[model samples]
Target: MADTTGPISTLPGAHHSVPAGVMCDDHPDRPATHRVQGETDSFGCELIDMCDECHGEWKAYRDTPQGGVCDWCGKHADKLRPRRDYEEGMYGRVYDVCVPCITRANQEAEEELERSGWYD
Candidate 1:
Protein backbone atom coordinates (compact mmCIF):
# COMPACT_ATOMS: atom_id res chain seq x y z
CA MET A 1 0.00 0.00 0.00
CA ALA A 2 0.94 3.68 -0.37
CA ASP A 3 2.08 5.70 2.61
CA THR A 4 0.18 8.98 2.67
CA THR A 5 0.82 10.03 6.23
CA GLY A 6 2.50 13.28 7.33
CA PRO A 7 3.25 16.75 6.00
CA ILE A 8 4.68 17.32 2.53
CA SER A 9 8.38 16.64 2.55
CA THR A 10 11.12 16.52 -0.04
CA LEU A 11 12.99 13.85 1.89
CA PRO A 12 13.79 10.52 0.28
CA GLY A 13 10.83 8.08 0.10
CA ALA A 14 8.50 10.83 1.25
CA HIS A 15 5.07 11.03 -0.32
CA HIS A 16 4.82 14.30 -2.21
CA SER A 17 1.55 16.16 -2.25
CA VAL A 18 -0.01 18.88 -4.39
CA PRO A 19 -2.43 21.22 -2.70
CA ALA A 20 -5.92 21.98 -4.03
CA GLY A 21 -6.38 24.51 -6.85
CA VAL A 22 -3.57 22.83 -8.72
CA MET A 23 -4.53 21.59 -12.19
CA CYS A 24 -5.33 17.88 -12.41
CA ASP A 25 -2.56 15.93 -14.08
CA ASP A 26 -4.95 14.00 -16.30
CA HIS A 27 -7.55 16.70 -16.85
CA PRO A 28 -6.38 20.22 -17.50
CA ASP A 29 -9.80 21.75 -16.98
CA ARG A 30 -10.21 20.18 -13.52
CA PRO A 31 -8.62 21.22 -10.22
CA ALA A 32 -6.87 18.49 -8.25
CA THR A 33 -8.00 17.71 -4.69
CA HIS A 34 -6.64 14.19 -4.22
CA ARG A 35 -3.60 12.10 -4.83
CA VAL A 36 -3.64 8.65 -6.39
CA GLN A 37 -0.83 6.22 -5.61
CA GLY A 38 0.68 3.81 -8.09
CA GLU A 39 0.16 0.09 -7.54
CA THR A 40 2.57 -2.81 -8.15
CA ASP A 41 0.73 -4.27 -11.15
CA SER A 42 0.28 -0.89 -12.80
CA PHE A 43 3.15 1.57 -12.51
CA GLY A 44 5.81 3.03 -10.21
CA CYS A 45 5.10 4.40 -6.72
CA GLU A 46 4.46 7.86 -8.07
CA LEU A 47 1.70 10.12 -6.78
CA ILE A 48 -0.71 11.59 -9.31
CA ASP A 49 -2.75 14.69 -8.51
CA MET A 50 -6.36 14.28 -9.61
CA CYS A 51 -9.76 15.80 -9.11
CA ASP A 52 -12.83 13.87 -7.97
CA GLU A 53 -14.28 13.74 -11.48
CA CYS A 54 -11.02 12.54 -12.99
CA HIS A 55 -10.74 9.95 -10.25
CA GLY A 56 -14.21 8.64 -11.07
CA GLU A 57 -13.33 8.53 -14.76
CA TRP A 58 -10.17 6.57 -13.96
CA LYS A 59 -12.16 4.09 -11.93
CA ALA A 60 -14.68 3.75 -14.75
CA TYR A 61 -11.89 3.09 -17.22
CA ARG A 62 -10.53 0.35 -14.98
CA ASP A 63 -14.00 -1.18 -14.60
CA THR A 64 -14.61 -1.20 -18.33
CA PRO A 65 -14.42 -4.46 -20.34
CA GLN A 66 -10.75 -5.16 -21.06
CA GLY A 67 -11.30 -6.25 -24.61
CA GLY A 68 -9.38 -4.78 -27.51
CA VAL A 69 -7.28 -5.71 -30.51
CA CYS A 70 -3.59 -5.11 -29.81
CA ASP A 71 -1.95 -2.68 -32.18
CA TRP A 72 1.46 -4.32 -31.80
CA CYS A 73 0.52 -7.91 -32.68
CA GLY A 74 -2.82 -7.18 -34.41
CA LYS A 75 -4.40 -9.84 -32.15
CA HIS A 76 -7.36 -9.74 -29.83
CA ALA A 77 -6.33 -9.38 -26.21
CA ASP A 78 -8.31 -9.69 -23.02
CA LYS A 79 -6.27 -6.82 -21.61
CA LEU A 80 -4.77 -4.16 -23.80
CA ARG A 81 -2.45 -1.63 -22.18
CA PRO A 82 -1.84 1.88 -23.42
CA ARG A 83 1.88 1.75 -24.03
CA ARG A 84 4.10 4.61 -25.14
CA ASP A 85 7.80 5.00 -25.65
CA TYR A 86 9.63 8.05 -24.29
CA GLU A 87 12.56 9.53 -26.11
CA GLU A 88 14.51 12.65 -25.15
CA GLY A 89 11.87 13.63 -22.59
CA MET A 90 9.08 13.40 -25.16
CA TYR A 91 6.50 10.61 -25.33
CA GLY A 92 5.73 8.87 -28.61
CA ARG A 93 2.37 7.65 -29.88
CA VAL A 94 0.39 5.49 -27.49
CA TYR A 95 -0.41 1.94 -28.62
CA ASP A 96 -3.04 -0.43 -27.29
CA VAL A 97 -0.85 -3.51 -26.86
CA CYS A 98 -1.38 -7.05 -25.52
CA VAL A 99 0.12 -8.34 -22.27
CA PRO A 100 1.96 -11.16 -24.04
CA CYS A 101 3.75 -8.71 -26.32
CA ILE A 102 4.67 -6.60 -23.29
CA THR A 103 6.01 -9.67 -21.49
CA ARG A 104 8.11 -10.59 -24.54
CA ALA A 105 9.48 -7.06 -24.71
CA ASN A 106 10.42 -7.15 -21.03
CA GLN A 107 12.13 -10.50 -21.52
CA GLU A 108 14.10 -9.13 -24.44
CA ALA A 109 15.16 -6.12 -22.36
CA GLU A 110 16.24 -8.38 -19.51
CA GLU A 111 18.26 -10.55 -21.92
CA GLU A 112 19.90 -7.46 -23.35
CA LEU A 113 20.75 -6.23 -19.85
CA GLU A 114 22.29 -9.60 -18.96
CA ARG A 115 24.34 -9.61 -22.16
CA SER A 116 25.58 -6.09 -21.37
CA GLY A 117 27.03 -7.42 -18.06
CA TRP A 118 26.02 -4.26 -16.18
CA TYR A 119 25.28 -6.31 -13.06
CA ASP A 120 28.64 -8.11 -13.16
Candidate 2:
Protein backbone atom coordinates (compact mmCIF):
# COMPACT_ATOMS: atom_id res chain seq x y z
CA MET A 1 0.00 0.00 0.00
CA ALA A 2 1.07 3.64 -0.46
CA ASP A 3 1.24 6.35 2.10
CA THR A 4 -2.07 8.12 2.53
CA THR A 5 -2.49 10.48 5.40
CA GLY A 6 -3.05 13.95 3.99
CA PRO A 7 -6.42 15.73 4.08
CA ILE A 8 -6.55 15.35 0.29
CA SER A 9 -5.60 11.70 0.59
CA THR A 10 -8.65 11.24 2.79
CA LEU A 11 -10.38 10.11 -0.35
CA PRO A 12 -9.12 7.27 -2.50
CA GLY A 13 -5.68 8.09 -3.88
CA ALA A 14 -6.84 7.26 -7.37
CA HIS A 15 -9.63 9.80 -7.16
CA HIS A 16 -8.08 12.68 -5.30
CA SER A 17 -6.82 15.17 -7.86
CA VAL A 18 -5.62 15.64 -11.40
CA PRO A 19 -4.46 19.07 -12.26
CA ALA A 20 -5.04 20.66 -15.68
CA GLY A 21 -2.70 22.16 -18.24
CA VAL A 22 1.05 22.08 -18.99
CA MET A 23 3.28 19.47 -17.29
CA CYS A 24 6.83 18.28 -17.40
CA ASP A 25 7.71 14.64 -18.01
CA ASP A 26 10.95 15.48 -16.23
CA HIS A 27 14.61 14.95 -17.14
CA PRO A 28 17.02 12.37 -15.79
CA ASP A 29 18.53 13.05 -12.33
CA ARG A 30 15.77 15.61 -11.88
CA PRO A 31 12.33 14.29 -11.26
CA ALA A 32 9.44 15.29 -13.56
CA THR A 33 7.42 18.32 -12.65
CA HIS A 34 4.44 19.57 -14.55
CA ARG A 35 0.80 20.50 -14.12
CA VAL A 36 -0.72 17.59 -16.00
CA GLN A 37 -3.84 15.51 -16.37
CA GLY A 38 -4.14 11.90 -15.28
CA GLU A 39 -3.40 8.65 -17.06
CA THR A 40 -6.22 6.62 -18.51
CA ASP A 41 -7.21 3.23 -19.78
CA SER A 42 -10.04 4.59 -21.94
CA PHE A 43 -11.37 7.66 -23.63
CA GLY A 44 -12.51 10.58 -21.53
CA CYS A 45 -10.90 8.84 -18.60
CA GLU A 46 -10.16 10.51 -15.33
CA LEU A 47 -6.55 11.61 -14.75
CA ILE A 48 -4.60 12.88 -11.81
CA ASP A 49 -1.27 14.43 -11.00
CA MET A 50 1.17 11.83 -9.70
CA CYS A 51 3.98 12.92 -7.35
CA ASP A 52 6.48 10.14 -8.02
CA GLU A 53 8.05 12.54 -10.46
CA CYS A 54 7.08 15.79 -8.83
CA HIS A 55 5.23 15.27 -11.93
CA GLY A 56 5.76 11.55 -12.65
CA GLU A 57 6.62 9.05 -15.26
CA TRP A 58 3.46 8.37 -17.21
CA LYS A 59 2.26 4.98 -16.07
CA ALA A 60 2.65 3.43 -19.53
CA TYR A 61 -0.90 4.65 -20.26
CA ARG A 62 -0.82 2.85 -23.61
CA ASP A 63 -3.63 2.33 -26.11
CA THR A 64 -5.68 4.62 -23.99
CA PRO A 65 -8.28 6.32 -26.22
CA GLN A 66 -6.97 9.44 -24.51
CA GLY A 67 -3.64 10.64 -25.84
CA GLY A 68 -1.06 12.41 -23.71
CA VAL A 69 2.59 13.42 -23.76
CA CYS A 70 4.72 11.61 -26.26
CA ASP A 71 6.08 8.58 -24.47
CA TRP A 72 9.28 9.52 -26.29
CA CYS A 73 10.94 12.85 -27.07
CA GLY A 74 8.28 14.36 -24.84
CA LYS A 75 7.32 16.65 -27.64
CA HIS A 76 4.49 17.30 -30.07
CA ALA A 77 1.34 16.66 -28.11
CA ASP A 78 -1.15 18.61 -30.19
CA LYS A 79 -2.32 15.22 -31.35
CA LEU A 80 -3.61 14.71 -27.82
CA ARG A 81 -7.30 15.07 -27.24
CA PRO A 82 -8.18 18.41 -25.85
CA ARG A 83 -9.66 18.68 -22.38
CA ARG A 84 -13.37 19.19 -22.89
CA ASP A 85 -14.85 17.61 -19.82
CA TYR A 86 -15.55 19.52 -16.69
CA GLU A 87 -17.80 18.84 -13.73
CA GLU A 88 -18.83 21.56 -11.35
CA GLY A 89 -16.64 21.55 -8.23
CA MET A 90 -14.85 18.48 -9.52
CA TYR A 91 -11.12 17.99 -9.75
CA GLY A 92 -9.55 18.67 -13.17
CA ARG A 93 -7.04 16.71 -15.25
CA VAL A 94 -4.15 18.04 -17.32
CA TYR A 95 -2.11 16.97 -20.36
CA ASP A 96 1.67 17.06 -20.37
CA VAL A 97 2.63 18.69 -23.64
CA CYS A 98 1.02 21.07 -26.09
CA VAL A 99 3.91 23.08 -27.44
CA PRO A 100 7.63 23.06 -28.24
CA CYS A 101 8.12 25.81 -25.69
CA ILE A 102 9.55 23.42 -23.11
CA THR A 103 12.96 22.92 -24.66
CA ARG A 104 14.02 26.45 -23.86
CA ALA A 105 12.25 26.36 -20.59
CA ASN A 106 13.95 23.14 -19.57
CA GLN A 107 17.30 24.37 -20.74
CA GLU A 108 16.95 27.55 -18.75
CA ALA A 109 15.98 25.58 -15.69
CA GLU A 110 18.92 23.23 -16.11
CA GLU A 111 21.31 26.14 -16.38
CA GLU A 112 19.93 27.78 -13.32
CA LEU A 113 20.24 24.60 -11.34
CA GLU A 114 23.68 23.86 -12.72
CA ARG A 115 24.89 27.30 -11.73
CA SER A 116 23.62 26.62 -8.27
CA GLY A 117 25.28 23.15 -8.31
CA TRP A 118 22.01 21.42 -7.73
CA TYR A 119 22.35 19.26 -10.86
CA ASP A 120 23.22 16.19 -8.90
Candidate 3:
Protein backbone atom coordinates (compact mmCIF):
# COMPACT_ATOMS: atom_id res chain seq x y z
CA MET A 1 0.00 0.00 0.00
CA ALA A 2 1.14 3.52 -0.67
CA ASP A 3 1.90 5.99 2.08
CA THR A 4 -1.46 7.50 3.04
CA THR A 5 -0.21 9.49 5.99
CA GLY A 6 -1.64 12.84 4.88
CA PRO A 7 -3.55 14.44 2.05
CA ILE A 8 -1.66 13.56 -1.09
CA SER A 9 -0.75 16.51 -3.23
CA THR A 10 -0.79 15.06 -6.74
CA LEU A 11 -3.22 17.46 -8.31
CA PRO A 12 -1.56 19.92 -10.65
CA GLY A 13 -1.13 23.35 -9.06
CA ALA A 14 -3.38 22.39 -6.19
CA HIS A 15 -2.89 23.76 -2.71
CA HIS A 16 -2.89 21.71 0.47
CA SER A 17 -6.26 22.96 1.66
CA VAL A 18 -9.62 22.64 0.05
CA PRO A 19 -10.86 25.93 -1.28
CA ALA A 20 -13.68 27.71 0.56
CA GLY A 21 -17.26 26.77 -0.43
CA VAL A 22 -16.03 23.59 -2.08
CA MET A 23 -18.23 20.56 -1.48
CA CYS A 24 -17.56 16.88 -1.63
CA ASP A 25 -17.90 15.39 -5.12
CA ASP A 26 -19.90 12.49 -3.75
CA HIS A 27 -22.08 14.59 -1.46
CA PRO A 28 -23.10 17.92 -2.77
CA ASP A 29 -23.95 19.54 0.57
CA ARG A 30 -21.16 18.31 2.83
CA PRO A 31 -17.94 20.23 3.12
CA ALA A 32 -14.87 18.33 1.94
CA THR A 33 -12.64 17.53 4.90
CA HIS A 34 -9.99 15.46 3.19
CA ARG A 35 -8.47 15.60 -0.25
CA VAL A 36 -7.83 12.14 -1.65
CA GLN A 37 -5.58 11.28 -4.59
CA GLY A 38 -5.49 7.75 -5.99
CA GLU A 39 -5.95 5.53 -9.02
CA THR A 40 -9.24 4.37 -10.49
CA ASP A 41 -9.88 1.15 -12.36
CA SER A 42 -11.40 2.45 -15.60
CA PHE A 43 -10.27 6.06 -15.38
CA GLY A 44 -6.72 5.46 -16.53
CA CYS A 45 -3.61 6.45 -14.55
CA GLU A 46 -4.21 9.65 -12.71
CA LEU A 47 -5.01 11.14 -9.32
CA ILE A 48 -8.26 12.62 -8.14
CA ASP A 49 -9.31 14.56 -5.06
CA MET A 50 -12.22 13.54 -2.92
CA CYS A 51 -14.03 14.56 0.22
CA ASP A 52 -13.89 12.65 3.49
CA GLU A 53 -17.04 10.71 2.68
CA CYS A 54 -15.80 10.01 -0.81
CA HIS A 55 -12.47 9.04 0.66
CA GLY A 56 -14.25 6.46 2.79
CA GLU A 57 -16.05 5.25 -0.28
CA TRP A 58 -12.75 4.95 -2.13
CA LYS A 59 -11.29 3.00 0.81
CA ALA A 60 -14.21 0.64 0.69
CA TYR A 61 -13.64 0.20 -3.03
CA ARG A 62 -10.03 -0.81 -2.32
CA ASP A 63 -10.85 -3.19 0.54
CA THR A 64 -9.04 -6.52 0.39
CA PRO A 65 -11.06 -9.60 -0.48
CA GLN A 66 -10.60 -13.31 0.29
CA GLY A 67 -8.29 -14.06 -2.61
CA GLY A 68 -6.13 -10.95 -2.45
CA VAL A 69 -6.04 -7.29 -3.27
CA CYS A 70 -6.86 -6.28 -6.83
CA ASP A 71 -4.27 -4.18 -8.63
CA TRP A 72 -7.01 -2.29 -10.43
CA CYS A 73 -9.98 -1.55 -8.21
CA GLY A 74 -8.06 -2.48 -5.05
CA LYS A 75 -10.91 -4.69 -3.88
CA HIS A 76 -10.53 -8.20 -2.57
CA ALA A 77 -12.84 -11.07 -3.45
CA ASP A 78 -12.92 -14.82 -3.89
CA LYS A 79 -12.02 -14.80 -7.56
CA LEU A 80 -9.36 -12.75 -9.32
CA ARG A 81 -8.17 -12.81 -12.92
CA PRO A 82 -4.43 -13.12 -13.14
CA ARG A 83 -2.42 -11.68 -16.00
CA ARG A 84 1.25 -12.33 -16.66
CA ASP A 85 1.93 -9.72 -19.31
CA TYR A 86 -0.66 -7.07 -18.68
CA GLU A 87 0.25 -4.08 -20.80
CA GLU A 88 -0.18 -1.04 -18.55
CA GLY A 89 0.61 1.55 -21.22
CA MET A 90 4.28 2.45 -20.76
CA TYR A 91 5.13 -0.89 -19.22
CA GLY A 92 4.22 -4.54 -19.22
CA ARG A 93 3.25 -5.72 -15.75
CA VAL A 94 1.73 -8.69 -13.98
CA TYR A 95 -1.07 -8.43 -11.45
CA ASP A 96 -4.29 -9.93 -10.16
CA VAL A 97 -7.50 -8.13 -11.00
CA CYS A 98 -10.95 -8.43 -9.54
CA VAL A 99 -13.82 -9.52 -11.78
CA PRO A 100 -15.71 -6.26 -11.60
CA CYS A 101 -12.61 -4.21 -12.34
CA ILE A 102 -11.77 -6.33 -15.35
CA THR A 103 -15.30 -6.09 -16.62
CA ARG A 104 -15.31 -2.35 -16.16
CA ALA A 105 -11.97 -1.97 -17.88
CA ASN A 106 -13.14 -4.01 -20.83
CA GLN A 107 -16.28 -1.97 -21.08
CA GLU A 108 -14.36 1.29 -20.89
CA ALA A 109 -11.88 0.15 -23.50
CA GLU A 110 -14.63 -0.96 -25.82
CA GLU A 111 -16.35 2.34 -25.36
CA GLU A 112 -13.18 4.22 -26.17
CA LEU A 113 -12.61 2.13 -29.27
CA GLU A 114 -16.16 2.63 -30.39
CA ARG A 115 -15.83 6.34 -29.85
CA SER A 116 -12.76 6.26 -32.02
CA GLY A 117 -14.61 4.38 -34.82
CA TRP A 118 -12.36 1.37 -34.38
CA TYR A 119 -14.76 -1.07 -32.76
CA ASP A 120 -17.33 -1.15 -35.50
> What TM-score do all the candidates reach, one by one?
0.54, 0.25, 0.39
Instruction: For residue 101, give model 2's deviation from the true position in Å.
Output: 2.3
The C-alpha stretches of model 1 lying farther than 4 A from their native spots are 1-31, 34-50, 85-90
- Pairs that clash in candidate 3: 65-76, 65-77
Candidate 2, residue 47: Cα displacement in angstroms equals 7.2
Which one wins on TM-score?
1
Q: Tens-digit lDDT track for model 3 on 1-120?
A: 111223222322222455566676667777766554443232322334467767777678656443878887777778775442224442233357788887877787788889999856
2 or 3, which is superior by lDDT? 3
lDDT of 3 at 9: 21
Q: Runs in model 2 with CA error above 4 Å?
A: 1-77, 80-96
Of the two candidates 1 and 2, the one with more favorable TM-score, higher being better, is 1
Query: lDDT: which candidate is best?
Result: 1
The list of candidate 3 runs beyond 4 A from truth reads 1-66, 84-91
Superposed on all Cα atoms, the candidates' RMSDs to the truth, in angstroms, are 9.9, 15.6, 13.5
lDDT of model 1, residue 80: 78
Can you give the lDDT of residue 7 in candidate 1? Answer: 27
Measured with C-alpha atoms, the lDDT of residue 12 in candidate 3 is 24
Residue 53 shift from truth in candidate 2, angstroms? 29
